[model samples]
Target: MSSPTTYHLVRPHVVTEIPTLDEHQQQVVDHAGGPLLVLAGPGTGKTTTLVEAIVRRIDDGAPPTRCWR
Candidate 1:
Protein backbone atom coordinates (compact mmCIF):
# COMPACT_ATOMS: atom_id res chain seq x y z
CA MET A 1 0.00 0.00 0.00
CA SER A 2 1.24 3.50 -0.90
CA SER A 3 1.05 6.33 1.59
CA PRO A 4 -0.63 9.59 0.65
CA THR A 5 1.60 12.65 0.31
CA THR A 6 1.00 15.69 2.48
CA TYR A 7 1.25 19.20 1.18
CA HIS A 8 1.34 22.47 3.10
CA LEU A 9 0.33 25.77 1.56
CA VAL A 10 1.76 28.94 3.01
CA ARG A 11 0.93 32.56 2.17
CA PRO A 12 3.80 34.98 2.07
CA HIS A 13 3.86 38.03 4.29
CA VAL A 14 3.50 41.36 2.53
CA VAL A 15 4.02 44.86 3.89
CA THR A 16 2.06 47.66 2.26
CA GLU A 17 2.20 51.21 3.50
CA ILE A 18 -0.23 53.93 2.46
CA PRO A 19 1.39 57.22 1.62
CA THR A 20 0.12 60.58 2.83
CA LEU A 21 -2.18 62.16 0.26
CA ASP A 22 -2.29 65.84 -0.57
CA GLU A 23 -5.48 67.92 -0.51
CA HIS A 24 -6.50 67.23 -4.13
CA GLN A 25 -5.43 63.63 -3.89
CA GLN A 26 -7.50 63.14 -0.76
CA GLN A 27 -10.53 64.60 -2.55
CA VAL A 28 -10.13 62.12 -5.38
CA VAL A 29 -9.73 59.24 -2.96
CA ASP A 30 -12.85 60.27 -1.06
CA HIS A 31 -15.02 60.70 -4.14
CA ALA A 32 -18.36 58.92 -3.56
CA GLY A 33 -19.41 57.94 -7.08
CA GLY A 34 -19.72 59.05 -10.70
CA PRO A 35 -17.34 59.27 -13.61
CA LEU A 36 -14.25 61.11 -12.37
CA LEU A 37 -11.49 62.44 -14.55
CA VAL A 38 -8.04 63.31 -13.26
CA LEU A 39 -5.73 65.64 -15.11
CA ALA A 40 -2.25 66.39 -13.85
CA GLY A 41 1.28 67.04 -14.96
CA PRO A 42 4.38 64.95 -14.43
CA GLY A 43 5.81 64.06 -10.97
CA THR A 44 2.29 64.06 -9.57
CA GLY A 45 1.11 61.19 -7.36
CA LYS A 46 -1.52 59.91 -9.78
CA THR A 47 -0.50 56.26 -9.48
CA THR A 48 -0.31 56.50 -5.71
CA THR A 49 -3.73 58.10 -5.50
CA LEU A 50 -5.24 55.37 -7.69
CA VAL A 51 -3.68 52.61 -5.62
CA GLU A 52 -4.86 54.10 -2.34
CA ALA A 53 -8.38 54.54 -3.73
CA ILE A 54 -8.50 50.89 -4.72
CA VAL A 55 -7.16 49.89 -1.31
CA ARG A 56 -9.87 51.93 0.34
CA ARG A 57 -12.51 50.24 -1.80
CA ILE A 58 -11.19 46.81 -0.84
CA ASP A 59 -11.17 47.83 2.80
CA ASP A 60 -14.80 48.84 2.42
CA GLY A 61 -15.76 45.22 1.59
CA ALA A 62 -15.33 45.49 -2.17
CA PRO A 63 -14.02 42.36 -3.87
CA PRO A 64 -10.34 42.54 -4.84
CA THR A 65 -11.10 41.07 -8.28
CA ARG A 66 -13.74 43.70 -8.94
CA CYS A 67 -11.44 46.45 -7.83
CA TRP A 68 -8.89 45.40 -10.41
CA ARG A 69 -11.46 45.37 -13.18
Candidate 2:
Protein backbone atom coordinates (compact mmCIF):
# COMPACT_ATOMS: atom_id res chain seq x y z
CA MET A 1 0.00 0.00 0.00
CA SER A 2 1.19 3.54 -0.81
CA SER A 3 0.64 6.58 1.36
CA PRO A 4 -0.97 9.72 -0.05
CA THR A 5 1.12 12.84 -0.43
CA THR A 6 0.26 16.09 1.31
CA TYR A 7 0.40 19.40 -0.49
CA HIS A 8 0.55 22.86 1.04
CA LEU A 9 -0.16 26.20 -0.62
CA VAL A 10 1.33 29.44 0.61
CA ARG A 11 0.62 32.98 -0.55
CA PRO A 12 3.37 35.57 -0.40
CA HIS A 13 2.83 38.71 1.60
CA VAL A 14 3.26 41.81 -0.55
CA VAL A 15 3.50 45.38 0.72
CA THR A 16 2.73 48.22 -1.68
CA GLU A 17 2.96 51.93 -1.02
CA ILE A 18 0.28 54.07 -2.65
CA PRO A 19 1.45 57.39 -4.00
CA THR A 20 -0.20 60.70 -3.14
CA LEU A 21 -1.91 62.39 -6.06
CA ASP A 22 -1.54 66.05 -6.77
CA GLU A 23 -4.55 68.30 -7.31
CA HIS A 24 -4.89 67.58 -11.04
CA GLN A 25 -4.21 63.88 -10.62
CA GLN A 26 -6.73 63.73 -7.82
CA GLN A 27 -9.28 65.35 -10.11
CA VAL A 28 -8.77 62.70 -12.71
CA VAL A 29 -8.93 59.96 -10.10
CA ASP A 30 -12.19 61.33 -8.71
CA HIS A 31 -13.95 61.80 -12.03
CA ALA A 32 -17.27 59.94 -11.83
CA GLY A 33 -18.34 59.44 -15.43
CA GLY A 34 -18.06 60.64 -19.04
CA PRO A 35 -15.13 60.36 -21.39
CA LEU A 36 -11.90 61.58 -19.82
CA LEU A 37 -8.86 62.37 -21.87
CA VAL A 38 -5.56 62.69 -20.09
CA LEU A 39 -2.91 64.50 -22.07
CA ALA A 40 0.50 64.93 -20.48
CA GLY A 41 4.15 64.61 -21.17
CA PRO A 42 6.22 61.63 -20.12
CA GLY A 43 6.92 60.99 -16.42
CA THR A 44 3.87 63.05 -15.49
CA GLY A 45 2.19 60.29 -13.43
CA LYS A 46 -0.49 59.62 -16.05
CA THR A 47 -0.20 55.87 -15.59
CA THR A 48 -0.18 56.28 -11.84
CA THR A 49 -3.35 58.35 -11.88
CA LEU A 50 -5.10 55.91 -14.19
CA VAL A 51 -4.07 52.96 -12.04
CA GLU A 52 -5.22 54.71 -8.88
CA ALA A 53 -8.55 55.51 -10.50
CA ILE A 54 -9.03 51.91 -11.50
CA VAL A 55 -8.11 50.74 -8.03
CA ARG A 56 -10.55 53.21 -6.55
CA ARG A 57 -13.33 51.90 -8.77
CA ILE A 58 -12.54 48.33 -7.83
CA ASP A 59 -12.49 49.28 -4.16
CA ASP A 60 -15.90 50.90 -4.66
CA GLY A 61 -17.44 47.55 -5.66
CA ALA A 62 -16.55 47.61 -9.36
CA PRO A 63 -15.61 44.19 -10.63
CA PRO A 64 -12.00 43.63 -11.64
CA THR A 65 -12.89 42.29 -15.10
CA ARG A 66 -15.23 45.22 -15.78
CA CYS A 67 -12.74 47.90 -14.66
CA TRP A 68 -11.34 50.00 -17.49
CA ARG A 69 -7.72 49.31 -18.24
Candidate 3:
Protein backbone atom coordinates (compact mmCIF):
# COMPACT_ATOMS: atom_id res chain seq x y z
CA MET A 1 0.00 0.00 0.00
CA SER A 2 1.16 3.52 -0.88
CA SER A 3 0.20 6.68 0.92
CA PRO A 4 -1.26 9.55 -1.06
CA THR A 5 0.13 13.08 -0.86
CA THR A 6 -2.16 15.92 0.10
CA TYR A 7 -1.77 19.57 -0.69
CA HIS A 8 -3.46 22.53 0.89
CA LEU A 9 -4.02 25.81 -0.87
CA VAL A 10 -3.34 28.91 1.12
CA ARG A 11 -4.14 32.53 0.35
CA PRO A 12 -2.33 35.48 1.78
CA HIS A 13 -4.25 37.84 4.03
CA VAL A 14 -4.15 41.35 2.65
CA VAL A 15 -5.12 44.47 4.61
CA THR A 16 -6.12 47.42 2.47
CA GLU A 17 -7.82 50.67 3.32
CA ILE A 18 -11.16 51.31 1.70
CA PRO A 19 -10.95 54.39 -0.45
CA THR A 20 -12.72 57.52 0.79
CA LEU A 21 -15.04 58.63 -1.98
CA ASP A 22 -15.72 62.30 -2.51
CA GLU A 23 -19.19 63.84 -2.38
CA HIS A 24 -19.71 63.40 -6.13
CA GLN A 25 -18.81 59.71 -5.99
CA GLN A 26 -20.87 59.21 -2.87
CA GLN A 27 -23.91 60.58 -4.68
CA VAL A 28 -23.51 58.19 -7.58
CA VAL A 29 -23.10 55.20 -5.27
CA ASP A 30 -26.03 56.18 -3.08
CA HIS A 31 -28.39 56.18 -6.05
CA ALA A 32 -29.48 52.56 -6.06
CA GLY A 33 -32.37 52.49 -8.53
CA GLY A 34 -33.15 53.81 -11.99
CA PRO A 35 -30.76 54.67 -14.75
CA LEU A 36 -27.61 56.55 -13.89
CA LEU A 37 -24.64 57.84 -15.82
CA VAL A 38 -21.13 58.46 -14.53
CA LEU A 39 -18.66 60.50 -16.48
CA ALA A 40 -15.39 61.88 -15.22
CA GLY A 41 -11.87 62.72 -16.16
CA PRO A 42 -8.91 60.40 -15.76
CA GLY A 43 -7.69 59.44 -12.27
CA THR A 44 -11.17 60.06 -10.91
CA GLY A 45 -11.54 56.56 -9.46
CA LYS A 46 -14.25 55.64 -11.95
CA THR A 47 -13.59 51.91 -11.76
CA THR A 48 -13.26 51.90 -8.00
CA THR A 49 -16.36 53.98 -7.53
CA LEU A 50 -18.46 51.73 -9.76
CA VAL A 51 -17.12 48.61 -8.15
CA GLU A 52 -17.89 49.95 -4.69
CA ALA A 53 -21.43 50.71 -5.79
CA ILE A 54 -21.96 47.17 -6.99
CA VAL A 55 -20.54 45.83 -3.78
CA ARG A 56 -22.88 48.03 -1.82
CA ARG A 57 -25.87 46.71 -3.78
CA ILE A 58 -24.87 43.13 -3.23
CA ASP A 59 -24.29 43.74 0.43
CA ASP A 60 -27.74 45.23 0.62
CA GLY A 61 -29.25 41.87 -0.46
CA ALA A 62 -29.74 42.69 -4.12
CA PRO A 63 -29.29 39.97 -6.72
CA PRO A 64 -26.26 40.26 -8.96
CA THR A 65 -28.40 40.42 -12.10
CA ARG A 66 -30.52 43.17 -10.57
CA CYS A 67 -27.51 45.41 -10.63
CA TRP A 68 -27.74 45.51 -14.42
CA ARG A 69 -30.37 45.78 -17.11
For each candidate, give its TM-score against the true structure.
0.70, 0.73, 0.68
Candidates 1 and 2 compared: the better one by TM-score is: 2
State each model's C-alpha RMSD to the native: 6.0, 5.3, 4.3
Error of 1 at 65 (Å): 0.8
Give a tens-digit lDDT track for model 2, residues 15-65: 979999999999998999889998999999999998999999999889998
Q: Flag regions of model 2 displaced more than 4 Å.
A: 1-15
What do the candidate models score in CA lDDT, each in turn? 0.88, 0.91, 0.86
- Model 3, 1-69: lDDT tens digits are 898999988988989888899999899889857888888999889988998898888888889888653
Off-target runs (Cα >4 Å) in candidate 3 are: 1-14
Colliding residue pairs in candidate 2: none
Residue-level lDDT of model 1, residues 1-69, one tens digit each, is: 898999988988989776989999999989877889999988799999999899888998889988643
Report how far residue 8 has shifted in candidate 3, in Å.
15
The numbered model that scores best in lDDT is 2
